[model samples]
Target chain A: MAHIELKNIRKSFGLVDVIKGVDLEIFSGEFMVFVGPSGCGKSTLLRLMAGLEDITSGEMSFDGTLVNALAPSRRGIAMVFQSYALYPHMTVYENMAFGMQLAKSSKEAIQERVEKAAELLQITPYLSRLPKQLSGGQRQRVAIGRAIVRDPKVFLFDEPLSNLDAALRVATRLEIAKLHHAMNSATMVYVTHDQVEAMTLADRICVLRDGLVEQVGTPLELYENPQSLFVAGFIGSPKMNFLNGEIASKFGANTIGIRSEHIEIADRDGSWKGKVVHSESLGSDSFVYVDIGMSGDPVIVRQEGTRHHNPDDAISIAPIPGKIYRFDAAGKPLKH
Target chain B: MTLDLWTITKRTAFYALVVFIVFVAVFPFYYAILTSFKSGTDLFRVTYWPVSFSWDNYISVLSTGSFPRNLLNSVFVASVTVLAALFLAITASFALSRVRFRGRSLLLMTILAVSMFPQIAVLAGLFEVIRFLGIYNTPWALIFSYTIFTLPFTVWVLTTFMRDLPIEIEEAAIVDGATPWIIIWRVFLPLLWPALVTTGLLAFIAAWNEFLFALTFTSSNATRTVPVAIALLSGGSQYEIPWGNIMAASVIVTVPLVVLVLIFQRKIISGLTAGGVKG
Candidate 1:
């Protein structure tokens, strides 16, 4: 395993800069995820680290050895692409054995390694089939198997689950979580625009925005104490609701942010009142959209299982005490 | 009754058009085959169908001075040209399509421009190069010149085809420690079977049919390629043409191409049309 460090890493394509200055360190055996919206340079940063793209200007070192000029193969890193990127003509066994064959490993050794990796991914049955014959999730597992047989010092995944259907994405995500635990010694860097993937799989989530690192912390750390408004908004699903004008002024801030799950429905006397505009029930949790007459869209509050709130019903909501996130004029978090 | 008549007329028209297109495309080759089987004045008679099956013309053409040798020459030239052109084109295309460098578009445009040049326009220049290389009068001359000319078309087609391959596959190969050559050989070349087959067949046909370079570069009857040898076929009188023998040679030369296309029609058609539309 290798500890990777990037200092002031920057990548530019022609006149346009994709990854501006970024500094981050990933420890050996850490599952680090670069999560951001599209065009936020998370993938680009991962590419830079994988040696797929050259760094424009930066210090990149792995295990204290500078590798800014190293080839991807030389970097001892294996990447799983979003498209699975399996050789369409190669059977699953050959696909997994390709890297080793290129490396001139013994045929017996290659067979052993390939079969082991295929077994680990539970794709042994399809080893004789070409990539075209396998389903999307199966193709992705073969890709991971291909990467695994490399016994790479660092593993890089570039949005590997985005191509699968929603159900398959979840199933594969769990598979990856198990994989990370199983291969505990290898450092892994994953990139995705999906916050749920980042939240669930990451040992530390690095939030990126427009070529800059917005925040880097554990998933809960980013959820609970996002350093800036961008992270506060980007790190959560259905978004962390914001009340900016009078409501925020009342709280002595420029904007007061609250996640829907952290907000409670008050029975009689609550901090804010609104009419229910919409609600979505997903068995485990229901999202209740309230027209609180706030600055932007209607505030959404999470109600646990089987909670029924009809549209047009008047409801009062309050943010859980001390759970409210306050930000100042610059979007930097304000001290509570 | 009127609606049924209208439908019948439209159906008749569609079938007629299809028959016309197929006949127009195939009639010449059919006539050549018909002529090849006939002897003497029967070649002159305009016949839509074969009147007789005589092996005399085939015998005469194969036994005639240097005709079979020329056939061998054409085969050698075409095969060598295809191999050389495909080798150069595949590597050139990988650079043109995948590698990002300054003047890449300019380089690709230059390749396309080279192929656009008429073969006759460069006849003298290529002749000189062939002579200077000391390969003139040898199959090497035709092979060398044909490879150069075929490269432009092959490279342009392969580049376009190669450009359509998923970039992620290349990156995956790279992560697998594939050198660009390995990526082309092991990863890319197999996926590119369609493009290769299409381009190689076209290149083979072009070289097999080439006359201008083959004639200019070779002075001996033995070294001349099939097209040139077929052109030089004559009768007892200057006014008389050995149409029967010529037809037999033509049929022989064309059989391989027709057979190749028949076998690979699906892949060739798909290769030609691939990346021309979005799925």
Candidate 2:
């Protein structure tokens, strides 16, 4: 296991800088996720850590050893790529055993490790099939199994689930969480554009924006006390609603953000008045889009159980007091 | 009834064009085989089909003189040249296509430009080098010269084919602790068979049929390849050429190439069309 640290790391392609400067530390045996919008350099940061891309300038160390110049394999890291990147010509068993085979491990050791990994991923039956013959989900499992056979100090995933369909993405996400628990000694750095994945899977989520670390905290820390407005908005699905102008000024701020579930639909004397614009029901819960005349775009309110909030019906909503997050003009949250 | 007639007319025209093209392409080889089976005055007649089924020319070509030796020389030289060219090209193409260097495109262009020059243009210079190396009048000289000419095409085709390979595969290999050599030998070589077969076959054919260099390089009957041997085929006297013996030798020389193409026919077609689209 390795504790990874990046000090003022920067990456550039020609004159265009993708990762300007970033500093972060990931503990040993921790699942650190890099979550951000596209072009935020989340994937690039993971690549730098994995030694797939050389950091233009900075100090990176794994367990107190400088690893900036080390090759990925030499750094003792195995990466699962978004495309699975399985060797098409090799059978599933061969694909998993390849890393160990390259290391010149003994035949018995390689066979044992490959078989164990295949069984762990429930891919034992498909071991003899080529990568092309397996479905996308199976291919990705083989890719993970390949990484597991390496038993590296660190594991890196670059949007490994993004290529799968919606249902498979969820199933594989659960599998990965179980894997993290099983392989508790290995540190993992995962990169994704999906905040839901970050929230559910990460031990600590590192929110990146425009090549900078917006915030790094536990899922509850990020959800409850976001240090910046960007992290508050980026970490949650249905996006945290921002209220500006006169309403925000009353809270002694330039902007105030509140989550959909934090707002309650009131019968009367609500903090904000609006009309129901649309509603979406998901069996257990329903999200009502209320037009509060905040430039026509609706503020979504998450309600438990199904509530028939029909369109064009008058509605009033109020933020649950302390749940509101206040931010200054520069988007940094004001101290409570 | 009218539609049926039109369909028949179009089908007839298509078949007629196909037959004409096939006859035009195959006539010379067909005539050579026909003449090889004829003896004496019967060979002079422009017959569309065989007049006799005689084995005299075949027996003489195989049993007498250094014809069999020359055939062996051609096989040895072509096979070695194809193997050598493919080995060098596969390695060179990995660098040209995968590894980024400052003047890669310029280097590739120079290689292609080298192939553009006529063989005769470099004949004198190559002769000096061949003599300097002291491989003059040997199969090594022919193998060396053929590799020089074939490397450019093989490398160019292999480079394009190698470029289309997913970089992710190579990266995965790297992460698996594969050295560049291992990647080439284990990972890439398997995937590269179609392109290799295609390029190797073309190089084999080129070396097998190459007459100018073979004629200029080797002097002895034992060292001479089939093309030169066929060219230097002697008749009973100085005035009359042994046309039948020459035809029999030509058919013998061409058979191996036909067999090779037939065996790798599918791979060659796929390899030729490889870079044209994603496989």
Candidate 3:
């Protein structure tokens, strides 16, 4: 494990700047996740840390030692790409053992490490098989296995689960969570646009917007108290609803952010009232979209269980106590 | 059911077209095989089918002055040319395709432009360079020239194929502690076998069939390649050309290429069209 710090790091491709200036410190053995919408420079930031992309200007140090000029391998970082990126011609064993073999490790050591990684990933049975023979999920495991055998100080995942089916994504996500617990000492920085993955997997989530750090906190901290309107919306699934104009002005704010689950279906005295426009019953929860006549568009209110409301049915909704978030004119959160 | 007259006519015409095309393409090689096995007056006759069978022409061509030596010279030159071109192209294409840099497209376009120049336009200039290098009349002359000539096509094709390789694979290799050279040899090279095979075979065929430079560069039979030797195969006098011996030599030279292409026919076809469509 290493302490990674980026001081005012900036990355640009000629004219268009991707990562403007980001300063972040990742603690030893920290599971730091970078999450944002597409093109927010989250992947670029990850690449900068992995030494894949050169930082335009800044100090990047691992464990108090500057690693700006170090090659990727020398930096002791292993990255799992969105695409598995396994050597297509090589068998799973060779793919996993390639890095060690390049370092000229002994044959026995190489095999031992490879088999260990394979066992950890439950891919020992497929070690002798070429990448083409494996399915998408298996191939990703092999890719991760390849990374594991390296035993790097830092483990970087660039959306490793993005390329799988829904069922496989869930299965692999669980496996990754277990993997983090299994390798607690290795600092991991994962980059993904999926906030659910960010919420579930991250110890501390860094929300990026336009190459800048919008906010960095634990998943719940971001959910409960977002510093910016972007984070308030980006950190939650079904998205945090924003009400503006008269409804927000009533609270002396430009916009008010409320998470779907945080809003309740009121019995009689409710802050907002509207007819149910659309609803999705996902067994455990029902996401009912209400056409509340607020300045904002239809509000998505999460209700427990299935099929609680239908279209043309009237309902009153209100946020739970002081759970609603207020934001001013500049999208900066306004604390009451 | 009885076949319709129109269907029968269309089928007959299609078969006739196919026969014509095959005959047009294969008649010369077929005739060479036939002529290679004939002796004496039969060489004069216009025989489509084998009227006589004799190994006399083959024996003469093989045993006669320096044909075997010329064959060896051709082999050495072509193999060297193909190997040199492919080795250089593999590394160059890796950089040109995989590594982004300033003026990459400009550089690639310049290479494409250089290859488009007519070979005859540079024949004199190339001859001078060959002589200046002191490789003229040696197999080195042909090898050097052919490698330079083949580099553009090989580089272009290989670069296209190399570009198609997923970038993440290269990044993964980088994280795995592979230098560019290691990645090329171990990672990109293996995935690129089919493309290499295709380009390598094409380069071999080009080097093997090359004649203008070969004839101009070498004066002695020992240094001359098979194509030049075959062209210069003559009888006692100027008027009398050894057609049978030429055909026999042609047959011998062509068999190896035919076998090579046949063996790697799949790879070459795929290689030639590899970058045209997404894999």
Candidate 4:
């Protein structure tokens, strides 16, 4: 296991800067997810850690040893790519055994490690098949199995589940969670744009924006106490609805953010008046979109269980006491 | 279903065009085979089909004189040239296609430009180089010259194919502790098989049929390749040419190429189109 540290790291492509400056430390045996929107350089940061891309400046150390010039193989890291880059010509067994074969392990050792990894991933049945012969999910499992056979000190996944279909994505996500538990000593860095993945899988989430570290915290730390308006809006589903103008002024703030689940449809004495626009029922919960007329966009109110409110139904909405997040004009959160 | 008049006419025209094309392509080779089987006066007749069958001409081409030696020279030169060209081209392709460097596209263009020069334009200079290398009258001279011409084409084609290979695959190999050589040999070579077969076969045919360098570089009767040997086949007198022996030699030389194409036809087709588009 290795503890990774980045000190004033920067990356640029030609004259265009991607990662300006970032400093963070990943503890040994931690699952760190870099979550951000597209073009946010999250993947690039993971690539830098994997030694696939050279750091433009600053230092990166794994286990307190500087690895700026180390080759990817010597970095003691294994990476699972977004595209599941399995060697198409190699059988699943060969693909898993390849790293060991290159390391010139004993033939029996290679076979044993490959089979053990294959059984762990439940891919033993497909071990003789080529990558093309397997489905997208199976191919991805083979990719992970290959990494397991490497038994690296660190694991880097560059959106490894992004290519799978939605149903398979969930199944594979579960498999990865189980893998992290089983390989608890190995430090892993996962990159994804999906906040759901960040919230569910990461022991600590590193939010990146415009090539800079926005915040680093556990999922609950980010959700419950976001340091900035960006983190407040990004860390939650249905997005935190913001009220501006007179409504925000009454709350003694320039903007006030309240998550969908924090708002309730109050029959009277409601904080804001609006007309119901539409609602989506997901059986377990439903979200009703309300147009409060003050905010340009409709406010989404998440309600428990199946709930129905017809379009144009006049309603009053209120955020639960002390639930609103106040932000100043510059987007920094104001003291409660 | 019954065929209408227009359908019949369209079908007839299509078959007619097909027959015409096949006739045009195969006529000369068919005539050579026919003549190879004919003896004496029958060789003079312009026959559409076989007039007689005999192995006398083949027996003469194989059993007599320096033809067999020349055949061996052709085989040696062409095989070596293909092997050398493919081996060098594959390695060059990795650098040209995958490795990032300054002046990469320019270097690629320069390589392509080298192939654009007419072989005759470089013939005299090549002769000096061959002589300087002290391989002027040996199979090495032909192999050396053929590789020079074929390298550009093989490198260009294999580079394009290698470029189409996903960069992620190479990166994955690197993370798996594969050196550049292992990546090329284990990961890339399998994916590049079709392109190799296509280029190797083409290079083989080019070297096998090449006559000018084979004639000029080798002065010894024993050292000349089949093409030159076939051209120099003589008759009983200075005024006569042994057309039967020439046709038989042509048949012998051309058969191997035909067989090679047939065996690798599927690979060649896939190779021609493989890197042209993303899969």
Using TM-score as the yardstick, the better of models 1 and 4 is 4
Model 1 CA deviation exceeding 4 Å by range: A267-270, B41-49, B237-240, B266-279
Show model 4 residue runs off by greater than 4 Å. Answer: B1-4, B268-279
Residue-level lDDT of model 3, residues B140-175, one tens digit each, is: 999999998999999999999899888888898899
Question: TM-score (0 to 1) of chain B, per candidate?
Answer: 0.91, 0.93, 0.92, 0.93
Sort by TM-score, top down from the best: 4, 3, 2, 1
Model 2 chain B lowest lDDT segment of ten? B270-279
TM-score of each: 0.95, 0.95, 0.96, 0.97
lDDT per residue for candidate 4 within A31-56, as digits (tens), equals 99999999999999999999889999
Candidate 1 docking quality: incorrect, acceptable, medium or high: acceptable
lDDT of 1 by residue, A1-336 (tens): 999999999999999999999999999999999999999999999999989999999899999999999999999999999888888777888889989998999999999999899888999999898777778888889999999999999999999998889999999999999999999999999999999999999999999999999999999999989999999998888899988998899889999999999889985544688899999999999999999887579998998897888899998988888888999999999997
lDDT of 4 by residue, B1-279 (tens): 356888999999999999999999999998889999999988898888776999999999899889999988888999999999999999999999999999999999999999999989999999999889999898888899999999999999999999988899999999999999999999999888899998999999999999888889999889999999998989899998899999999999999999999999877545332221122
Docking class of 2: acceptable
lDDT by candidate, in order shown:
0.90, 0.91, 0.90, 0.92
Least accurate 10 contiguous residues by lDDT in model 4 chain A: A263-272
- List clashing residue pairs in candidate 3: none
**Residue A180 miss distance in model 3 (angstroms):** 0.9
